[model samples]
Target: MRIETALAAVAVFSLGLSSADAETPFKLGTFERNGRTFPGLVLEDRWVVDIAAANARLQKQHPSWKALAIPAGMKELIERYDGGLRERLHAIANEPGAATPRVDTYEVKALRVRPPVPDPETMVNAAVNYVEHGAEVAGGTQAPTPSPTMAPSVPGLWERPANDIRWTPYLFLKARSALIGAGEAIRIPPGRDKIDWECELAVIVGRRASRVSVGQAREHIFGYTLEDDVSDRGGRGDARHGSDWLVGKSHDTFAPVGPFIVPKEFVPDPQALAIRFALSGKVMQDSSTARMTHTVDELLQYASNILTLRPGDVISTGSPAGVGFTRNPPVFMKPGDVAACTIERIGTLTNPVAAGP
Candidate 1:
């Protein structure tokens, strides 16, 4: 579909409404059935419509129209998203019995719900981006005292805002191979105890971005999804090199992302959502994105200045306080435990913990 047509369709479907509106319909994700993966539209009662198949049918019906050719995969859709594809999707969703056998649809419970972007180029994560989380992880202590009688600080000598006690959005890279979808197992590697859960709001990059300013960062975001930044607290580096995030954070199935990816247009404010997670039906981390010290735009701007962010790159915008490692006596996820992370507007991403080989 033409980009303008697609955009107009989304406008008609959403009526320029925010996701918080009760009338907003449909969320997006990827699903697997019989070993075949396709983009899907999440429906009521754990059912989903295979959009790729639906688009194929639409194309066959309208051979003369060139605009019916929608992107086949999530990454392509995001990378090329203009208004046309979204509008086409809205039309497909509005079709009567679209989720019925006429279109390829399946009960989500009977199939696998994979990560929205199954293969991102890079997954960048923000560390301690929330004030309370930074304090909690630092044992709620104050910064060390500066030497008494020190000379008055010069501009270069004085710490910049980015380098001061106020935590900047410290970014780290996670292995894309570690990603798993909702309902998948987060296998706890043997001998690595203290596996903790961090429910974070993850942003999916829609376009190529490099050195974008904070004001322009929002323009490059395609959508928002939930991510559980699973960590092995015991694997952190000791007194020498400090915490080894790669070893602690990058394990197979360490990043359990998505139940769905809500389009950025649907989510009006990325920093105002309520985020929470539970372990085995017991609520653990419960907070709002409002508590974040550095907003999603700031984090994106910071990271883009350092390196290029291509389409399908994921930026995990940090978790709130209440992580297990910061708790008294430390609590961790054990095998057989279920971890569920939820964000308002965005859905819940639940994964079961299993013993690794």
Candidate 2:
């Protein structure tokens, strides 16, 4: 019963206009069951409350409250989240009894999980945002770094952002067609042998932002989710251009994202989180965001400078060192493989690998 109470407490935290009490923290995602797809509010990492159905019930119970239209999909929900909808969601989560699966709630394990945000306005991804990752994936096959030796008080390459102008984050646009959800199959294109994986921490933009500074970036952040920046090492299998950013990275099923979204309120420090990836239960890329050459704020600031960031837009902060193509023997993801990308405080995004038709 104590464990159950603790779970209820998470969704029941109060949000104040003055000096606030602890804010309620919850995850948002798109899930499917039977035949319909709906947005879900995940509580305590175990339960999923069907947003549309629960809100309807809440409104019926309290006629005094203004009725809000149910969102048709996840993207619509995110766009309307900050505007009156979030408070209604809070009401649904903070219902009288313990927060258990009720009429409109179900165990998350039972649902067919879809990408947290089905359609983002845009996906701006950073390239080589981690220093050591830059070194290892620079060119041909690489051997692992010799040791964790830092000249300072530590013995590692973990350091703060470089002061040079080179630290300005380089951003790329990813096609919306590439996105797939948790537990979905990552179809390896036929004839393209070298399939790689890059586990990254993706930032979900909250509001429409443009020209925002690093200091103001946090406010624009809606939440954080996991993105597997799956790559095709054999670029187009031809030297059409020096590099084929679109073809190499934009293949269908290349971007496996989300199980759900962890609101920024819960993630106090995005850079301090431990991000890792594993294949078929074997650890592959294990690193911390602490090693990022450019922090989330910087990337947000830079990306917003060039283009406006809309609600539900994803900015994949880039992956860490241990990529498959960087190994001496050059490991690659093949059929019958399962890749999982995990972030601290957030859940994992696992996708099964399969061959294309």
TM-scores vs. true structure, each candidate? 0.86, 0.84
lDDT of each: 0.79, 0.81
Model 1 agreement with the true structure over 223-295: per-residue lDDT tens digits = 8998999998885546668768888899999999898888786688988999998999999988999988778
Candidate maximizing TM-score? 1
Predicted structure 2: clash tally: 2
* lDDT by residue (tens digit), candidate 2, 176-199: 999999988999888988999999
Candidate 2 deviation (Cα RMSD) = 6.9
- Kindly give the stretch of ten consecutive residues in candidate 1 with the minimal lDDT sum: 153-162
lDDT of 2: 0.81
